[model samples]
Target: MPSHVWNGDDAPPNIHDVYDYIDRELKTLKTKLITKIEKQFFGGIEAIQFLIHIEEIFKSKHRIKRVKSLIPRISGWAELDLFTRTCYEVRRPGGGRDAGFTKDIQTFNAAFQRGIKSLTDLQDELKDLYCVVQTFCRNYQSLEGEFDLKWARETNLELKSAMRGIETLLEEAEEGVNIKLFSSDKFSLEVAETCDTKRYPVLRLFPDLFQKFHFSFHLIGKWRANDQIYLEDIQFKLIKTKRLQRLKHEEYNTLEIEHANLLSIIVEKRVRVKCREIRDRIKNLDQEITKLAGLKRSMMLEKSQTESDIQERKRHLFMNKNVTDIINSKDLDNILGVKKDIEILSKKLKSLNKSLKLNENDLVAKEKEKVALDTDYEDMRKSVSRSNQLAFERTELSKEISIINEKIQELEAIFYRKTDRNKLSQAFEDMKYPAGDDEE
Candidate 1:
């Protein structure tokens, strides 16, 4: 007989067989998932490891009695006797040949079919998610310490697209499972009447974690390799324990009820046989909680240290505001003004230098001319002495000419002064003599 297609056969598998088959299938499926996850670790393990962490979350959510009772039946992974009894009751009303009962069985079969189909689809989705993750991990590894702009952009796009694909696949897988659950009419009404199904917190928050990883991808170009790794690891664990406080809250309630229940049972029945088991389980839970708390504290400390290191790096690499402002000055007008002043000063300096060069040339030429004239004067005196014996007299006459020129300048000065004095005396005599003497 086919595993999924169960026509109203004379030999339908009993509930035990059905559950056993499902359990085996579930184990196989888990093995496949683990194998796929392990292959994903070829490039890196952070993202895939997150998926494993999600398994822990699933286990925790389903650990509750009510949730545990609902999940298996609803998902068609296991069936409760109540569900089987309800199916039989519907059939018995028509003496096992009711057309409506057959229809109901068909519907039930279809729901299981859908569940099986969803499982297959979920596997495919997981495969695809791992492929993207593998590609993303490879890119991350190859692009480590890569600061090339073009490469970074392309790699970021690829990584981002891969992240989105992973997220989409995860959502589809979740929806597929949920749809499978809702398809079963026997369990649907029952599930709805009971406590609301609590979704896996990590599943809901996974994309956010994916986002955190992607965000770290952006920092690869700017942050040190070690820093990026630390950031991702720290943030990954942080997100893992993000719902811990709430879990602790739930744990408190669960423990109280469980404690009371255990006490009542032990007091009423005097059952010591199961007491050790219960104590061991409680001890294990306490140990788990303690480990989680310790992990959280360590992660927090690492985060703080990382932050401080990053700050120190920034402080060392980046200039202070004042210095940075001066180097990258945005004050256009001030810059322009300074430039203009420098240009004007440069022009003035060039002009002054040119003038000084010209003056130096003129002085050099005049000095050469003076030397030439001195040589000519000496030659002329020598020629004069050679041609005539009166060279000495000529010299004496030249001296007399210089003396006479001086005397001429002095005599002219004396004559001008005497003439002014004579005019004044004459004026005085004319004033004394009057107009009558002038007429006579």
Candidate 2:
């Protein structure tokens, strides 16, 4: 039957039949997937075709959910419902571009951890068709054992397209298994090929606790070489079904050891989980310390730079104020401005004193003449008063003589000491002076 053309649109395969038949057919195909593909030591058992149908159903229903779920690390990242072969997703809180991505990642991780129940559910989904397919493949392999290469080739040829379709679906199945795998690191590699629908290959690699192992659905396709029966992808995966049970127990112990190991390293007893968690914290500290040191060093460098700038603008303790006010200070730089003002004033005072001395000499020479002129003027004024009858002539003569006597007196006052230049210069110098010194 063409894969797309279901046995009947109206009637679906019994969920049990689907699971069992696929499981049986998977046994042979699983070997083909492993032997043909390049892979590692431990990949878990996978119901390749069953997963493909799950993906198909998922795509038919929640296409976007199915698409987005594909981003997880591997197929095993999700939980399986083996009984119904019905898959659900555990999405990261907010995986895209949002602050919620972090929260979503955490949620996804938690769901993946709870995936154990999902895997066990796979057994419940097997049924009638599973037996038919299993029997059919067994018979085909029996013929092949009898060197029926032509029949085997012709069989593969007849199912080539369907085989390819199954291969394509299997490739997309890993992510369709569950929601948690969205952010989990778990993923599948070296998946099954188109020709191998007779069997299925599943692998699960867990670094923290679970040991890696291979799953094969084959029984009849077992290759016997050198008189030794080499179970390839056929019969069973690299691991025996028996070992899986032991692995589960060991996996739990490993998980405990991992938790205790991490607890010891955490320097805190509250968190009780994987050793990987503690290692992560230690790794985080390495980053934190580096960042802290970088910031501290930067601050120190900035402080030094600021100090250098201050030094460039600093003034001597005593000269700060004066230096700030000076404009045309170049000439005055050598001579203290305060001191220079005093010196300039002293020179002016000395010049004034010399002029005073010359005035004194001139005054002495004019003193006797002024005294004689004053006596003549007084006699003329007395005559004017006695002979007022002399009228206008006498009055005019008296006024002229009085003016002459006033002029002579004015000369004496001018030549005499009025304000001493020495005293003025002394007062000016004393009023404001430079620091630390005072002098004439």
Candidate 3:
């Protein structure tokens, strides 16, 4: 028979071939799914950039509002025309003269609207891809379980069949030897004739006869050749059994290595996905921190202006009249309200400063978390052996993120409280002292 022929009676069926085929299919599917996940993961960058661009647009709009507040309203057509032309020159800077603030604002609003729509669409797509990947992971887990169970069942059956074959061979050898030595009359007569000259009985010669027949048939002159051949076959089978077991062990090791490789691929992809999510969150935190810093600067500026205004009012009162005359009911109430406004602004500034510090601290913590996540991601990506360790690290990072979110919520609450207090203090100040013509 040809060496490649696998259907021979003496040859055990190569059951591992079936497992190899299944494993190949699984590997192909895993590769395709991993590729899809990577593509989607990288594709999310465009969406992230869109969101960042939207934030930039909002920032630009805020700057425009500040500039508009600084520019007093122009009356009459000539003044308005001059202001419009100046705005166009400053904003366009060597571009068209027709470009003006209104046009610029419209353009920015249109871009913002487009960006919002694109971001919405991309977010939806990303969510769908995320769902698909989750489903794939669940299915892969089920497939892994099936593969393990199938492999175990096949290996167990193979081992049991091999043991049964060895037992049958041993039983056959024992039965053949016992019948030839104890139940054959012809063999007994031959043994008696051979031992007659030595005056040895059959029972006395039995040990020597059995040993002679078992080891070397030449001592008995080739008598009962079939029994000698059977004994030699049993010895050959026993000697070859160890070689078969070694081959089985090597095949099992190969299978285990392949399974480990597949599992590592799954784990590495999961880590990369999680790392990307953390990175995006860190970016959002950075943006929020920048926004909070701007708010803090604005609040400080407002507080300084309020303090200066209070000092100016006190100086005016002392310079324009006697201290006793300035202490009338209306003047006293105005002074007290100015002091109250100063006090309220001071408290708000303090609260805002505290909130800003907390945000900075949170930002630092999140940055550190990002670095740790990056390190863990790299380690898991590069080393297959460490994939099992990622789960614990992932859990710890999740907890840290939750804590940071709580801190952010508290900061926001403080900010809102400060805003409400500022509004109440402004109301009291307005009621106690109405705006003068020059201040208006």
- TM-score per candidate, in order? 0.19, 0.16, 0.24
User: What lDDT would each prediction earn against the true structure?
Assistant: 0.40, 0.35, 0.41
Q: Compared with the true structure, what per-residue lDDT tens digits does model 1 show for residues 1-440? A: 54664221222233223223333444454554344432332123454343344334334434445545654333222332233334434333334334444444444334433433543454454343333222222212111222233544555565555445444434553323343223122323333333233343222222232332333244332222332343354344334434453454455455455545544434422333334444455455456545555555555555555555545544533434235445445554544554565455455555545554554555455555545545654544444344343334445555655554544444344333223445334433444454568454
Using lDDT, rank the candidates from best to worst.
3, 1, 2
- Give lDDT: candidate 2, residue 153: 47
Off by over 4 Å in 2: 1-102, 113-115, 123-132, 140-440
The deviation in Å at residue 424 for candidate 2 is 99
**Compared with the true structure, what per-residue lDDT tens digits does model 2 show for residues 1-440?**
43643231122233223233344444534443344321221224243443454334333323345433543223433322221122223432543532243333333344344433332232222222223333223222221242234543443343333233333333344444332221122333222332121222222222111111121122112211100121122233213333553554455455455545544544332222333454455455456545545554554455455444434334332454465565466635644553454455455545545555554455444454445545544544444343333344445545654544444344333222112344323323333343477566
Model 3 RMSD to the real structure?
Answer: 56.8
Alpha-carbon runs more than 4 Å astray in model 1: 1-76, 80-86, 89-102, 121-129, 140-440
Supply candidate 3's per-residue lDDT for 415.
Answer: 31
Error of 1 at 228 (Å): 22
lDDT pick, better of 2 and 3: 3
